[model samples]
Structure formats: C-alpha cells, structure tokens
Target: MVAPFPASFLLGLPVRGSRGERGRRPARCGPLRPPPGAQGSCSQRCGDQSGPCSCHPTCFGLASCCADIRDFCLEISPYSGSMMGGKDFVVQNLNWPNPTDSVICSFKDSIQTRGHVDASGRVHCVSPLLYESGRIPFTLSMDNGRSFPRSGTWLSVHPSKVSDSEKSQLVNETHWQYYGTPGTQGNLTLTWNTSALPSDAVTIELWGYEETGEASRGPSAAGVKPPTPAGSLEMGERRFQYDSGQQCCYTADGTQLLTADSTGGSTPDRGHDWGSPPYRVPPRVPGLSHWIYDVISFYHCCLWAPECFRYMNRRPSSDCRSYRPPRLASAFGDPHFVTFDGTNFTFNGRGEYVLLDAALTDLRVQVRTQTRTGSEGSQDRGTGLTAVAIQEANSDVVEVRLGEGAGVLQVLLNQEVLSFAEQSWMDLKGMFLSVAAGDRVSVMLTSEAGLEISLQGPFLSVAVLLPEKFLTHTRGLLGTLNNNPADDFTLRSGEVLPPSASSRELFQFGADCKGPPAGGEGGTALGRARWRPAAVFPGAVQNASSLLTYDSKFLAWGWWPWLGSATGSYAAGRATHMWNPGTWYPSFSSRVPCSVTEDPNPEL
Candidate 1:
C-alpha cells in the first residue's frame, strides 16, 4: 500500500515556522503562550485545497491549525501494530527548546502515556493493549502536564498475524499455538480431538462474521435478496443469532449471557467434566475432552486436521468425518427407550422424563412429552415428545424442539433460539455438536462422551443415543445403564420390580425416576434410583410458566424443561408450564413475558 504522506516527509524537509520563516524548523511547538496563540479554523485549513501547516502536529487540536495536520506534518515509520500493543510510535521532530522538556502521547482521549523524545527529535511513545483491532487516533503533547487536546492521529492495530486471504505459512509444523480471527477463537483445547485429526495434509478454512457487519440483505442484479436468519432465541437478558438455512462448522460465544443484576454475563455453564460419567468411572484419559471439533457460529471454520496447516476453500467429505462409537444407546419410536446398559422399555406416560442424569459431574438430558395427537386430534394411543433439553455439565442449555412447521426444527442455546444462517452444523458447546435436516432433525454430540437426539416431525417422536460410560452409572426413565433388564424398573427404593409389572406399576416407576425428587430439589431419599434436575442455568423457577413457551417475563432459570417455581417433579423439569410474569420485575419476581417453550405450537 502507498503511504498517505508525500515523499518530502521521508526526506524530512525543513518546515516553515510562519509566512516568512521558510527555512526555519522549530524544535517543538511549545504552548500557545503569547506569540502563536491557537490560530486557523479546521473548516478552511483541513480540506483538499489546504497547503502546509507551519505549526507542529501537536498543535493541531489546541491551535485548530489544520484538521489533517497530524497526518500531514508528522512522519511515523511502521504506522501499524498488533492489538496487543507494545511497539513505539516514533514521530519525527523531537527538537525541543529545553533538552529536559518532555513530550506525551495520548490515545483514544483517555489513554495518555509518556513519550520519550529521542536524540533525533523523535518522540517515542509505546502503544497500549486494546481489546479490539482497528484504527486508533492519538495525539502528541509537548508540555508535561500543562495542556493537550483530545483527538490524535490514527494507528492501524490488527489481531491476527496473517493478513486477510494470506497463507498461515505454518508447514508440517506441529506442537505450536494457533489462533483464528479476533471473533473466531473458540475453546479449541476442549472440543477438537487430535486422534480424530486427519493423517494426511489438512486443509483448514477459517471464516467468521465481522462483529461490525449488519445482518442486512440487499437485492442483487436480478433484485433478489437472500433470506435472513431463521429466528431470534430470547432468554431474559441474552440472545443467540441464527440463519434461515442450517449450514455446518464452527462455534462462537453468544453475546455475554447477562443477568439483570450483572454487568457482564458469565459463561460457566459451558464448562464440562470430561473425566467420569459420575455414575461409573471411565478410565480417565489425559486429553479426552477435545472430541471432534470446537467451533462457534461466526466462523465457518473447518480446521480439518491433516499434516500441513494451510487455508483452503474445498469442503471436507462426510466419509472422512464418520465416527463409530464403542458403545451406544438409543430412545426413539413412540419414545421407547434403550438404557446405557442396552435395556429396552416403553413408558407411555407424558409430562417430562429424564433421558439421562449424571449428578456428580452435572451432565444430564431431559425430554418434555405431551399427549399424542394425530392429524385428527389428541390420540388415546399414549404420548409423544415435545422438547429435548441437553445440559452440557454446567454450560449452555441446548434445547432442540419441534417447530410449528412440519419439517422445521428450532434449537435454543441457553434461552435464545439458535439462528443457523447457512451452516449445516455448529458446535454449540465443547462437544462436537451438529444438527442435520433429513428424515428427522437430530442433534448429535459426537465428542468422546457421545450422545445423539433425533425428533421426528408431525408426530415428534424422539430418538436418543447414549455413550458407553453411561452403563450402570446413570438414572432416569431410560433406567440405569446396568445390563439387567429387570432393574430397568428400579425405583428410588431398592425394590427391584419384575419385567411383567402392571401398567400402573410402570407409570409409578416413571414418576419415581422423573423426580424434582423428594428432599429439596434433586436430593431424594436413600437408594431412590431416579434422575433429578440440577440448577444448571440461573433463573430456574417453579412458576406456572416453566419458561417453556412463555414469552412473557423471563426471570431466573435458563435450563430446560423446568425448575422448582413451586415443585412438581425433578429439580427443574416440566413441573408444568411457567406462569406469565411480565407484570412483575424479573429480579424481584419470577414473572415472565410468555412461556419460553421453543415449541411454536406448545399446548400450555
């Protein structure tokens, strides 16, 4: 790129002082004093028709000499720097009247630091670290603490080492740190597994939406504008953005999940315990959390792990990314179940049911089921699933729901709807989370702690896949993962029921397991073998709304399917629906705008 200044700056031309002082170069433009009091208005001296400014660049704002005086009068070498600032911005012309006099450099108005006037009349100022990357304006102050103007010159600060569309140039090199663009760097240590990395040369494509870009759509040559985001998922104080079509790859932290009282929201819920199932201890591997990929929404990054690290546009094939788990369990059909121990059973009751709950580590799954309805009306043939909520340890509550439209599905991270622009898959959490639109909408967490949930549209039949570690360690309607089929009907009591238990017995067993529990939330009686809800997300309440479909006052509890607004079952399941709390202040009351059920046509 060409420099914005003329070639005379490089040669350090002897600048004029006033109209007649042509060859005279002032050491430094001292304070206005009595002689050269601030002169010249920017309106007349700052435009294209203007000529050289005799005063110093430091005198621009104070004197209002020339608007472009900083850029025009000062010559700074290497004008750009990294956002993690430390480099010096040397402005030529350190010539000061008194050798002991000091010069100060000011940035962004508030950031004023000392500028060392070097031997060559060069003002050496160190830049400060900036949270964002962009053009920063700064100014030079000649007097120690006397007076300095607000605005300064511009310095370009960049976040990434490689410029746009430039090669990373990291060849065959391993054991090195890598960072994506400013907004694209996600939790790489947790989601991406080196074992799943390609053995051959890898082609990585890093793409991210600029935080500054508006989600606007304009017509093309044919005057056709593409579709916008699918929907906006609104929790009490946070929102997640999505697109019209579900494309794949990458992940990003949503806007800070702030509560009403807090200034910045905490993202602690995304932290997971990868070690044990909390039911049965799996032999801990050193680095197991890095499953398939750890990406966010903005960056459509496919860091396909091959040999060399280079940027490319070609997409990775499905055949190359297939994963075969060592052990798996499923729940589908009229919502029949398969335990981690591979036990199969059919529970016809509705309300809410626990698919899996690991208490100690905090990984759990709960599905909301309502009475089955055919095209005619509510059918007497049992119940169907409505919503499935997956709590990744303490992190985001990802609730996959059946949309009002037949083939359409909606995903809510925390309480906000996930708007998938064009990507087919997104890693909502540390897990290699992905969603596929096909015969059914499925959310598959392909990390080492495997899990997959699919919901059939129209009918809303759900199918869930459990990892092997869940064996004998989990509790819920799906039953303990232990291989004993008879124990599948085990209640919180040590009483083991026979396989031929009556319909009434099965219903009670489901109730025992689908617990907000007996003792204060999930703390149940001894030997009560059931799944209970944990207060994973803040703002969980037992108000009638249950936050399912209530778009009203969104108070505490961001978890799905419910919390103890008053208590029904499970720590926070569908104790029913949340009562609208719009009338009351969220912080003071559990009021809601509307039932936050992601379901478009929820009954409640």
Candidate 2:
C-alpha cells in the first residue's frame, strides 16, 4: 500500500451510492486547513466520482458524508486536473522539425495504388529530439491525430489506408518523426524516391507535438507552424486555362498539355492512380473514363494530320474557273498503319475544286475532303479519294500542260492560294500544309511562272503523343504556324518532289509529266505531311449548360470552353470549328456583356 500522510482530517463521513452501481456518489470530509509549513498538507481528490471534480472527489456541491474510517484514494487519473508537489519547474521548448514536412516521394513513373514501394529510397524520418533524450515514449496514429498507440522504430503509410481526401487530392504519407518532450531542439530528415510515386500529382500532411514538463506550458495548439515539405515537391498552387476550340486544358504558368476524360452526366475524374487496374478518365458520354479521340471536326475529321482539301460547288458550272468559296470538310482520316489509322491514302483527280472568285475578308475555309479511305478496290475506283485541282480564267487547259502556256494566272489568294493554268497537272504528293492570313494570294504566287502551287494549311488544336524527345520538330512546326512571325520555309531543287512517278500527278491514269520546280510564290517550301486526329478537353462538370444560342438578327453565344468556369478570361484570337470557314474569329470574355462580333460561321 502507498504511504499515507498525517491527517488532522475527518473520516467516518457518510457518502451515497447509486442503485445497482449505476451512478456512484463520492464522499467528502469536513473542511480541513493546514497551518503554514505543515508537512503533507496537500489537498488532493479521492474516490471514483463521475463528471467534473477538483482536488477532492464530490458529487455535485455535496462532499461525501461517509462515516467510514478508511480513506479511499484515486489510483491513476487519466486526465489530471492539477500539478503535484509544491516546487515549480519549466519545460524548455524543443523547437523540433516536423516529421511530415520532410516526408515525400515522387514517382518517376506512375505508381499503382496500394502497390508497395520497396523500402529502397522511400521517405523515412527519425526525430533527433527523441533520440537525444535516449528513451522518450511516444504514440502513433494512422487516423490522423485523433487517437494514438505506442510505437517504436518507424511508422509506414500504406497506399490502401489513404483517405478519400488524400486519394482525391493525390496525397501520400511515407513516414513521420516525432519529439516526445518539450524544451529540446531537434530536426528531422525525409527522403523519398520520386520515381516510385503512382501519379504525377501528389500532396502530403504531417503533424507532431511535445509534452510540456511537469510545470511548463508551450504556446496554444493553434499557433503551431506546419511541417516543411522536402524533396522536389513545391509548396505553391496550380491553375488552368481552357481553349474551347482545341477542347483541352493548359497549365497557366507553363502551358503544359493536360489530358481530360468525360464522365457523361457526372463530374469528370482527375488524379486517379495510373496503375489502378484498367484505370481511365471518365467517358465523354457515360460511365466510361477513356477517350479514343479528343477533337473531331464535323464527325471524324482530325487536325493533327496534314490538312486535306475538298472542292465545293456553289452552283453546277461546266467551267472549273467559276469556282465556289472554300470551306473545310465534315469528315477526317485517322493515321496509323495496318488498321491502326494508316498515314497514307490513294489520290483521285475527278473531285470538284472551288475558287474564292473574290478575295476573302476572312481567309478561313471549310473544305470537305473525304477523311476516310475506301476499300482497296474502291481506292482504284476513286470512290472516297480525290485530287486537289485549280484552273486559271481564260487559259488553254491543254497548252498550259506542254509549257507553251500564255496568260496571267491567278496568284496569292490571301497569301496561301496556288496559281494554275487551264488543264495543267500539279503534284500535291508529300507536301506539308501551312497557312498565313492577310496577304494577296494571287501576287504571292505570280512570280513562279513554272506552275506555282502553294501549301494551304488548315489549323486544328491537337495533342502530340510521341516521346518528349521526338517532339522537337513537331513543336517547332506548331510554334511557327501559330503567329511566330519569324518563320519562313524555302524550297530547293529536287528537294520536295513527290516520292514516285505514279504519285507525281493527281491522275495516275494520265500521261508522263516531269513536275516543275516545287516552289510557290515568295519561295515557300513544301515539307512532308502526316495526319492525325485532334484531342478534345473533357468537361470539368458535364453538360453544365448551353453556351450558344441563335435566332434572327440577334444571336446569343456563351464563352464556355468545355471545362472552364463562366468567369475565366482567355487571350483574344481566331477560333476554329468544323462547320465554319477557317476565317471565323469569335471573341469571348467572362465578366463582360456578350457582344457579337462578325458571325464567325462560314456560309455553309
């Protein structure tokens, strides 16, 4: 039994007990005050009572009135109300480093959720403050700081135990270090293998505390500085911008491409671990979370490949010179080999070709080219393929073919149109399409007396999937095409001629023809061409509302770009769409009243 102090105290006091021990009341002795310097005069609580109590255990305001001679005492107080002893001591503030701050692991490759990241290079923290004290007892809690259990050595965070907030936010807990006592200075080191992270995005949260000495108290819990992050992960925030025409989201600071998946009628998913079985973004229509193609002009037409040309007739005219204004096709071709979206197709010479007739204030066109190739037999029959042809007004079609042509051919139609003599054949094989608006197309090609053919390119937003290293030329091409101002291409002898004699002319059935110098007006060079579909940005919140409205003289249009909020601002520029001509320029703003510019839709 523990030692008992001298007591001038009163016992034999009567106390009350609850029915069936449901509620036990405490017994209290009459008030007893010790004189100054009296030994063991400490007034402490005794007996097991429920709810609030001071030094002495009592039920409500009534002290125990028990009349027993034995003095009952409290064995252990889980939550102590007061400090013991008459001496005062101060616990030093340890100023320890937070264990969570230094804990991080960025996976160089995608990590599968719950997949064990081998202990090699995984983040681990050992508190110097705790070790310096030799043996400081501590507890660990996986369910945050709510509860703790005794722990020695190290703590591990399995990806499976990741909470909804952590998973949704892509956060991971590699390890944490803690200090058990106050007044000790300490530091923690965290290290992780970034190559082991499951997803590209991640976040982490950590917390720790030190117990004050018997007589000391630190600052309130609210004033604590959070853990400092370690490794390559930064501590800033991220933002995004939406290009409606491209149907994709771009990082604001770096303009990096971001992938999106539609979730049909529900919110689209982001930040899911890539290694999860059959992981995918939400389907653009419903429960699906993956997309085969992102941007499809009209229906299946893609923008990543060479821009195909289609001839449209405003009216049925026997003369090819009386052509219609240009417009984009409603269909597109997928590029791959062996049923994997092949990159090549057979050419036909009989398809219709159109002329602007008059120069365009806006040079954008909506040309309808057959995006899909027909069966092998149909290719020979010219069912869905055709050649791009042109004819000059009042010129002999046959004479121009033999180099004995005479007449002023139509040149530069907005800096991209090609000039042609009546009935002359121009080879379009292996040519890259590029376009620049606001120039005289007829004059741009007038200097090339040797059958000037221009590369008229159509612009469409697309995502490049090749390895990062291979994207150099592709990225340069895109940058030059998009208002880079300093870009120019010049053709050299025999440099850009079509690959084979059969591919040289639009009509393989026609007579032999040695192609002329492959350069248009202004010395524009032709490069090899390849085609692929464009990627579209998935909606942030699906089918939010209609962004476009139409009627008579008054039309209403919204600036919603798939996943963007109604209040975002985008830089002003030309916009592209399948049903409209290439010249359409639609402007949008988040806060300003919707004011209509020239109707961007082409005359379909």
Candidate 3:
C-alpha cells in the first residue's frame, strides 16, 4: 500500500487521501458527453441535427440554453418571402411530431388556426395580415410546449385596402363566362369572353351540362310496337285476287291450293280436269311425241338388230278419238309397215333409224296396246311380238325373231331383262338410260303365228321426270263451317297450327262464338280454356263428347252417358298446362319497355 505507482495506472480508479484530506476521482474514459441542459435523449441528440440540441462542441459553448434552442428553430424554419399588399400569406415550414402532433397558431382572439403536420413534417398553415389593428398577437406551436419561445409574440405589419382595379383584375383572372346561341340543325353556336383571360392561355374547352330533371313522356318514349303474332296474316293495305280462268281449287275454308297443269298451256288450270277423256293429244304429251319415238327407237336398235329398224313417216290424225292420235305413232313404223306382209322387213336403209339424244336423262314411258292371236290354222296361241334394235359402229341393225307362244312382253336393258308384262298397256316410271346423242336406233318384230298388232287411242308418250313437289293438306273439320271466298288464306312454308286451336273448333265454326279476340288481347283466355275443366264444360267438352256420345248410342245408348262427360272433363284438366303456351302461341311484345321514371331521391 505504500509503494509508489505511475499516474496512468490510477487514471480511471479512485485514489485514497490522507486524514483530513479529500480524495480525487479518476477522469471519465469514454467520449465527451452533452451538456446537462441539452434537450432530448443522448441518442436522439446525436443522430438528428434538427433536434432541440445540435450536440456539437461549438453549440455547447453558448452561454444560455435558450440561445441554442433559438438557433436550432431558426435554422430549420422555412424561409419567408415579402408579403404582397391585401393578400393572405401562407407559412408552410414548421416541423412537428408525426402522427400525434399538430401546429396551432393564434394571431388574435378571433383569429386562430390549427392543423396537423403531415408525415413529411410540412405544416399546413396560413397567416392573414391585420395591419388595421396595428400590432397583432401571434403564437406558433408544434404541440403542447415543443416550440421555440413557447409564448405569444407581437408581429408588426400594415394591412392595406384592396383597390377596386386590383379586385376587378382578380375577378377577371379567376372566373369565366360562356354564351350560347341557337343554331341550325341540332348544333349550338357557343362563344366565350376571352378578353379577361391571360394572353398566354393556348386552349379553351367547352363542357355540356347534364340534365337533372325527369325525362320527356310520350308514346315514342314508351317503346316500339310489338311484332305481328305468328300464324296470323299481316296484310296491311294490300289486295289480292284469285284468277278463275286458271285451274285452281279452294279448301272448305276458301284457301286456294295451287297445282301444275300437264297440258302445254301457259295459264294454270284445275289439276283434276287435266287428263279428261276424248282428246286428240294425250294428257301426258302436249305437242309432238318425239320423246316417245326416240324411246321406242332406242329400245329397238339397242336390243335386237342394230341395222334393220327405220324411222316412221306419219302425220297427225284428223280425229284423236277415232284411232290412236298421231302422237302415238311408233318410232320404228307400224309392224305391218316394217314387215310388209307379217313375215319379213328390210334393215339398215338410209334414214331408217331415229337418233337417241343424250340430253334425255330421266324418262317416263307409257304404252297402250292389246295383244292378239297369230295366224289361224295353228295350234299355238300367238304371243306378243318381239322387236329388237341394235347399234353398230358402221351400220345400225334390226332383228325380229318369231316367238314360240310366249305371251308376256319381256323388256331388256343392256342385255339384262328388267320386267315382263302381258297387260294391254304398261306405265314405266323412273327409267334411267345411258344412250348417247346421235346413236342409231332400229326395230323388228316377231310372233308365233303372224299376229296383228294395232296401236290404241293416244297409246304412247314419253317425258322427262321433274323435281317432286311436296303438298301439305291443311283441311280441318272446322274449315268446312266457313266458306267465304273473299277471305283469303295463304299457306306459307313451315306454318303450324297453334296448340289451343289444334283440336278445338275454330270460332269461325259458328256465328254464336266470336272470332279470335282482336289483336291477341283475349287469345290467352282461349288458350286457358284448352286446359281448364270449368272452361271446357261450357262448350268445348260438349263438342268433343258429342262424337263419343253418338258412337256410344250405337253400342249401349244411355248406359254410360256420364262416362263420356267424365272423360271429357278429365282430359281437359290433364291437358291444361300440358303444352307450353309460348311454343304454341305467338307473342306480340317484341320490344322492351323504356324506363323513363325519374327517382326524386336516390341513395348517396
């Protein structure tokens, strides 16, 4: 304890002193500490220069703590600018605590402004001059006492009156007015006062004002009229006429039905009266029977001798009813003409064959002839003659073979037999042939005993097949009740009867029941009757049950009369709603209603 030591070893340690002497404390080892009067924690003062204390050595030398506070506040305060006369000035620099701190300024008892500082420490502040009152009391604060010179102070400034000229300039610079003039069409001529605007302004814009009142009310505003109901005719002012001269038939309901005339006439005629008897020309052929001749010649030359047949030289008959019309003349002359006697004939002569044209594709052939027995004194009954026509490269030929009592006429196509017949006449339809134009056709005939063959009245004809037409029958029992020819009814493709009227008798059945309600107003009632038992009991049930009652009378008169009524009622009830009315009936409301009602008060 008495040994001496270096001063460095005792620098940080407490030293012992002699009796009646004070002990000396060691010097602090860490960096210099801030003055006792410094505001805020040590870490805060060290990091933030704008804090209450700068914590710098130079600032610490100040004699008064308030001096340092004053200096810090001035350094961070926003720079001020000269104030213009008669205008409010804004001071935006005060830094306040975030979130919870606010800046409150009191210029006078009646002039106090308070606002919060943003996160960025920018103060939302404004100061107005009060020069008329001379010195004005001004006090600024962040919150509570966190402000320099935490007390009210007086600031001196003169407030001058705003001049009339200056006020006019400000009014002109701040506001704009627009003038509108009505123009042609729907356009408006708009002009604005640009004299008050600044010279540097480049563009001016116009805006339209939205209407806040109720919309206009009228029929046009309501909506467009609905479309015409389906299955109903919409003949507006147009007129139609039916030609009686033209062959036409009308249904019991007066709806005209159209048909094609088989005769060579431009006017349409009644289809049923077309093929009546006692005519020179056949119903199937209108003019010359070239098709029939060509068909006969084709068969003759292609099937038998391609060299013997020849075209017939004939003329129209004076009377069609007396003998076969000239139209029935054979393409390969009559058998007697070809055979001379009934045994032999020539072949391959010049102008001897008719040419088959390729333009004929689908063909229909009708032939009428009665078979007869051959020559007498023979035991064999004569079969129909066999005629053949063959086409050859150099010359066409015709071959005739005597039959051995075969009565049936056998038809062959390309060496293949198709059909055989023994009737007086044959009607062949849907015949497809492949003969080319300019192809030679010939004919020859044979029989067991030289039999005689004669052509019947208008016996033969040929024509091309046309496209099939689909005819729809729309006749209904109710159609017979009304037969007014003036009331026109047209059939359009794809039109179908409404379900309500499908089985029910139409109103046209009797005058007692009114026609279908005008303009679809009461049609729904009829549709409802189709399903409602109560509605059916009035008339519909009776109409439907009448047939059953009539039939039941024959079986057992009044034995089960109630059964029919019960069934009718049950059917009506079951059928109600069974069919969808929308699918069966037509709708008139094709357009949506417009919404023009204005709400006086709407939710914000």
Candidate 4:
C-alpha cells in the first residue's frame, strides 16, 4: 500500500506551517555502532554491556549502548501500524536531545530509516510500508546497523487490505517505473485490451524519466503530482506523436529508453530503447543519490491521465513485474539539491561546505564554491562549484578541482596530485578516476565505495550518487535520509534550519557544516585550512532580490540570487509557467506566465 507523495511537487505551496510542530526536531547525534571487536565476540543479550560498551536504553543518547540495544534496551511504540508507512513509529525509552549517538530502524533488512528525537525527545521515523502482513522482523541499530541482530524485535504490518475507497487517491497517482539491471535503454510499450480500438488515429504520449536512477529531477514540479525534489538536474521533456499504423516514433534525441521491455521486467541488456531514441534525460550524478521509489501526479499529469488510459484499462496478468530499484539523492548546479528523502532546495553559499557525513563508514564529503560578481557589481552574488573533496573511512582525501579556466581540472589524492595532463584514466584503490571529454572529472567509487562523483567543467557543477546505507547513516546540508522532508534542514549540530531563514542565515547555516575544526569530529581535508567566510557578498549592498523566501502555498522553494533578480527562482511559478512550447500537442499559449503566485491556475 503506497502512500501519497508529499505536497512539495504538487501545488507549489510552502511547507512551513503545513508540517505542524510534529516536524520539529531536537538536537541530532552521530551514529554509535559497537566497537570493532565488540560484535565478533559479544553474545546476544541485554544488560551485557560488561562485554564492551554500556547497554541501556538511556545509554543510546550517550553512544554507550550495546550493538543490539534496540533488541532489549530500547522500545518502540504502537507495535502495530498500517502498511502504508506514514504513522509515527517511536522509540519509547531513548530520551530526546540525543547528542552523541543516533538511532536507526530496520524494517526487516531491506529498508532502513533514521529516527529523530522529536519535541517530546523520543526517537522516531514515520512508520514504514510492508507488502507482507503479520509480525515482520524489525530491529534497531544504535550504530547504524553494523550489527542489526536479526534475532531482535518485531513490527506488525496490519493485514487488512486498503479498501477501494481508501485507494481512490492512488488512481490519481503517477506510476513511472525504472528499468532494471543489464540494460541501458529499452522500448516504450503501451498495452491495451482489444475491445477498445485506436479508431480515430489515436496518439500515445509517454512520460517517464529517461536517465538512470531517481525521479522528479531538474524540471519544475508544476503539473507534476509531487513537487520536484530540490537540487534536481536541469532536464527537458520529450514528446512523440503516433498516428495509427506507425511501427515506431522517432525519439527526440535518440539516446535513452523508457523501459527495458514492454512488461517492464529486468533482463540482461536485451531490449534497449525499444521504440526510438531518448530525449531530455540528464546524466546520473554521484554521491548526492540513492535508490527509493515513490509516486506522484500533479494537475497537469492527472488531467491527461484519464485520456491516455480511457480505452486501455486492462493490465495483463503477465505484466505483474516487481520492481524495487534503488533511489538517488544529488546536489549540483549553483547548486540545487535533492535530499536523501527527496527535499529540493538551492544553496548558493560560498566557501567549503560539508555535503554529507556518513556514520559507521566515516565517509565525509566537502565541496567548495566560488562566486562571480554580476554586472551590477554584486560581488560574490553568482556562485559556481569550484572543487569537491571526498574522504572515506580508510581512503585518502580525494579532491577534484576545476582548473584556471573552462577546460582544465586538477585531481589531488590527499597531498599527492594526480596528473591527467590530458584526457586519461587512473585506477585508485578500487575506484576509477578519469578526466573525460568536455572538461569533466568522473570519479566512479563503486564496488568498494558506493559513490560516484561528477564534477563538470568551467568552474564545475557537481553531482554524487549515494548508497542505500546513506538512508540512516548520513546528515549535513543534504539533510537526513529517513524519507521524511520535514527535517531536511537538520544541521549536524542537531539544529533544524527553518525555511524562513534569511539568505545570510542560509549562508551561515551551510558554513557551520564545514565540519568541526581540525582534530574535531570531521576534520577539514587538504587545501581546506580555514573555513570560507559565512557571507559571500560581505560588503555588498543587500535588498529583496537577494533575500528571497519560499512561497506560502506549496513551498515551491523561491530563491533570490545574491545579486541577480529572483524572477523564476520561486519553484511555485512553474505551476503556470508553460513548459517547452514545442513539446505540447494542441498547444495553447506558447508560454503562459503565471497569472498569480498565491492561487495558481491548474489549466495552462
């Protein structure tokens, strides 16, 4: 039973007051996994802290609990919950203001959620959705699951099926599935029953993401059911026209496929881009990504759904495909961000900032930004990514930096600089690094580290692909990955930055995560000695254009650049702002400016 997507991608309204006080979080804590040899020798038992660390429900906040504390020490409230996963699942004993250790909830072993200490000081993540019924194996990981202890606790997924009435909302939900393993591109299969005919030169319009991993990226969330996640890639949409008897429709750009095959099943690179070529799908970003799945459909998508399926109601029994692909979280541009939980927002702060800090694994990422003074002499108003530094538990600090101009870049591993004098590839540890065509550095940290970092040319635009472990093991500017956006701005200090924070506040907030001073928890990397100034335009004059705020309705994140006009930064404006004029059939206005921001017209 899938729950509805958050309002973010919908009406483009503000989420400020929409979440209520329940969203408020107490200070956060780092992860507290058991010591290295603790899990290997320690037997399974509560109150057995004598073996290593103290084991108690209260000890969790202090990072002194046993690995299986959640098994016997801590407890969860409401043992039973709906299969849909929106209900709050709380840890009863672990008090709030947990400063040193974090709590992780494991649903069976497939899904993990980061639990937060609420205003009441209890740890929790909204309940989870389980396709199966009855007592499911549920456990806790005080150390981010280094030892899940499958022998521990349970959560009952209510067996009751959602009544058709209860599922009415799902009828209007967006249903886009990702293609699976061993396939690059595939065919777009539109299956319909024979009873209804394509009698009137019917045309099929297919809308699904082209690139691999993650969804609702780049484009405005307007007309989309769920608002687009923050920091998504900038991508365009593709359109195809099909009259009767046309074997195939030409793809807009001819690179990506909608699905691997008609039935939407995974196979070994069989069907790649079935009908035609791909269009408007951006390349995959590294570090800032993951692999979760969800569904959302806005007014534009909803209005057209009925027409597309008017005569094709039957889903073939053979089409029963089970697809649970990994989801991605990324940050790029100047730069927009899609949090681990799909929260989208733009951070234009300058200086070195921590992208995310992973617990257990000790993987830390810090990025540097440089700003350009606009024609208005707005010093440091326009910012661009300059470098990205990645450090894993045992790995060297890998820094990929932009060169002097648009076509050069430098790669440094710890203090040893890697010379790619020209376009070349070098294998480091278990990962591969290459200065590819177009002044870009691609760091594929797969197999050994679940990360892929892509730093573009000309001062660079960066993207990272996150691992599934990131869900409950990370924090920083990218926010918590618990599939809950309400706390997306949660700072490492455990403070949740409010949506109403001014530009200066936003700048300062990001600066704080540069990671505690050297010798502190997460020390800075090479070439990063002093933290960048909190203010980008230090002595520059400031006004409304630079201190923009989020809209009232859908919280479409409206951002005012440091020195430029705030014009289209408000995401809500996309609701009425017409998309590419050439993409729409039966075109209305070539481009319709939003009539009003407060109350947007669903019909463009």
lDDT of 3 at 272: 14
What TM-score does structure 2 among the candidates reach? 0.14
Better of 3 and 4 by TM-score: 4
lDDT of 4 by residue, 58-176 (tens): 23333444554543443456444444344455666454443345556677666666655555555565445332233345666554456654223333332232222222122312241
Error at 281, model 2, angstroms: 25
Q: For residues 375-491, write the lDDT of model 3, one tens digit per residue.
A: 664422211213332322222121222122433222333222321111111111111122112121112111000111222211111111111110121111111011222111111
Q: Which stretches of candidate 3 lie over 4 Å from their true place?
A: 1-68, 71-94, 108-110, 129-137, 144-156, 159-604
lDDT of 2 at 255: 48
Clashes of each: 80, 60, 27, 51
Question: Top model by TM-score, which number?
Answer: 1
lDDT of each: 0.41, 0.19, 0.23, 0.41
Query: Which stretches of candidate 2 lie above 4 Å from their native place?
Result: 1-228, 231-327, 331-380, 383-604
lDDT per residue for candidate 1 within 1-604, as digits (tens), equals 0111111111111111111212223354443321133234322132221222223322322232343344334545445554434445566533443334455667766666676654444556666543223346676655553555323344433233212222122322221133443434444321122232223333332212112212212311111111213332111111222111211222265333322223122222111223111101111100111111112211233232332112121222122134545555666666677655566677665555566665544666777665555677756555666677776565556777666657667666655455444233443343434566533444544334555556554545554555555556666666666667767666655666677877656655553322242443234232133224322221122333232332222223433223434353332332222221211112213222222232212232
Candidate 2 residue 590 Cα shift, in angstroms, is 52
User: What C-alpha lDDT does candidate 3 achieve relative to the native structure?
Assistant: 0.23
Per-model TM against the reference: 0.38, 0.14, 0.16, 0.33
**lDDT tens digits, residue span 1-604, model 2:** 0111101000111111111221122233344322222222112222222222212222212322122211222121111110000111111111112222221111111210111111221212122111010111222222223332212211111122212222222112111111222332344333343333334554434422211111112211111111323323111211211111122333457442322221111111221211111111111111111121221211122122232121111111132244432211111112110101112223322221121111211111111122222344242222221112222232212110001122122222111223322112121211111222321121111111111222222211112112122111211111112222222110112222232323333122111112212232111221101111112111011111112111111111222221112222222211112111221112122111111111122121
